[model samples]
Target: MAVALSTVAEAMLMDPALTAQIKPYEPWLLISGVFVLFILRRLTCRALRHRVDRIGYRLFGERGLLIWFWMNAPGVILHELCHACVVLLFRPFGFRITKITLFRIKPLVQERPYGMLQRGMPQALQLGEVQYVRPPGRLVSHIGDGLSAVAPLIGGIGAIIFLYWVATGYNIWEVRLQLIRPGWPWWTLLFAPYLILTITAELWPSSQDWRGARWLLTGLLLLAGIALATLWYTHVLVFNEALLQGVASVALHIDFALLALLILDLAIFIVADLLNRLL
Candidate 1:
């Protein structure tokens, strides 16, 4: 199985290689990284979020959700803005984003299962949402909708990278080389982690974003496969490594930034879980 499109879209862009040494394992390595990301997002991220929310709820009830939503304001705005921005770019192609909501004040009421019985829960609130209108069943709409659905992912990752640069003097290679910059200000790094938390938590596309995206993406994958096969057969296909490797490098960096967030989230989760149990 492939990585979820929204999570690691660039992994799918791996170009076919001509070299026996790097070609075979490059895609596999990228795929594995994506698989790990999916696992982390599904299990680790989910657990961390839920654990914190549990603590908040235990303390403040539904009001806790409101507070949590407000705390994640940066990410919420970025997420919705990503959708609206990308969708608006498709305006030339006949798509119009009808609404751009940064955040909402109301709680999301839904049913939950408890002992084979369902009960309504009002502990969840929507932080932000973007709504677009497009002609149904058109190829253009499908492509537009699919791209827009995953825009938050690209935006979130970009935000993380930017925050890291702002805090670390953008010394990416220094970090890689295990060299610490002397006399770095401690306060410069203060808000990056919290901002990253907000971004990652809100990055995943909501189920509503996938309403018209799955079919479009499936079709795209099929088309890409056919294109690769056809071009490979012609013997004139250019085996590009530089571009592919560059993209992979950037993606790896993005993943590492996210890994840092996961680490911090784990620490927070431990504290939240412990506090919840005691209180």
Candidate 2:
């Protein structure tokens, strides 16, 4: 009965037009987001100092920093990207991979039927696979997460450099225009804070200092919700129809995707916590 309900719910959530609205520029946003994430990490380590060390130790033991860089960071990026890429590759018909934000405010992949109950069942079932990748074997399974996280960092830098090279050949005005042109949308700048907060929140070790980190994560989540609401109310209401239209178009699926990713992230954190306890 549960399986049947889950399958039926999944079928209802599939929408090709909605999916198409979500794709197109995800890779670029992902790459940019990664670069921003690495920068924030460096800043956080330098500024937070002892607090970070404590969090790291709590999450990953003696080699906390190494574990964070190699394990958690990568794991998160991959986890998010897996949703985006998988939808792109497999459910191309019903899925749209529209926009990928450097900020992890929302799910990497937004689908149709964004309602909680409507979205939750399908995601819970799909993410069941991640559970199997556990323990000793998990170290390897964790690799996907790590690589996914790191890929954007590497790709983003490469892209910026490539853009710089191309810009060099043009006139000064042209170069200026190019830098602030068709490629880099003005909206990206506006979204920077959310991206920074999201990445930092995600990659920061959340186990040993579970209480503190969890509190922080909870706060960030609240802030994200507020920001999304504000954006929807102001921009969608006053200035442009595009903002509301874009959001409305993807609203249903986004809810489902966010719920799924949150569950997966929680699972990873739980697994890491349990492993730490066992060891």
Candidate 3:
């Protein structure tokens, strides 16, 4: 009943006049949705990590860190594999992945006064790491590094979609928020949340993943500027309606996906908050 109501509401919200008015701004809305979801997801991830750590520690000891790492193993694998796949795509361009570790606790290495190395102090807990060497030259470096770094963002979306389909036998929009159908297998209910929570927990890229992206973004902006200049000079500054609508469609679905994750994280956050305060 609730799902039916939501479906109707979704249709009502898609009034042609309102959509036409907002068509040009859909891209902006997508960007804003992604940014907002990023912030909220990070907070929830941190809280859940903290709660898991505390709970594990309370149950165990230093070994509790293992629980945390394993809990995020699925996410780590997806995130790092995404990076590796993109790096491999540029392999012909001289990119090579040297090492990939899903999770490790590494010591903080320091140079002694005599130039000797002192380590093994349990410095940092790495959820995942993908070490790769990029080709020389600025353009290739920028594009290769940026794409590899942000590959998880794109891959995560694809993965979420696939997992959703596996769980519901329908695309998210088709589900219309009706995740648990009347006559579905039990595995559907079991996988519906498990797979999604595991992956979306680490769907975002860290600050380190964004290193070379600034230069790439700068390059893109410059290219866009040049294209706009050429278009205006030729008096052909026209936006492609089909392309815009296509982008809008994808963005709307992505925003919907992110919104779903956001709500789930909110519920997890509330529960974690309660746990943190209590135990």
Candidate 1: segments with Cα more than 4 A from true spot: 1-34, 107-124, 171-185, 234-255
Model 3: lDDT equals 0.69
* Per-prediction TM-score to the true structure, in the order listed: 0.70, 0.23, 0.70
lDDT of 2 by residue, 1-279 (tens): 999999977765586765576566544444454455445445543433344444667767765643333323433453345334433432323434444432222221333321010101111221101111112333332333333323333443333334333433322222133334455445554433233333434433222213212434465689998987897677654545455446544443333323323443454455555555555
**lDDT pick, better of 1 and 3:** 3
Cα TM-score of candidate 1: 0.70
- Lowest summed lDDT window (length 10), candidate 1: 112-121
Ranking by lDDT: 3, 1, 2
RMSD of each: 10.5, 22.9, 6.7
In terms of lDDT, model 2 sits at 0.39
What lDDT is reached at residue 190 by model 2? 49
Candidates' lDDT values, in order? Answer: 0.65, 0.39, 0.69
Candidate closest to the true structure, highest lDDT? 3
Please rank every candidate by TM-score, starting with the best: 1, 3, 2
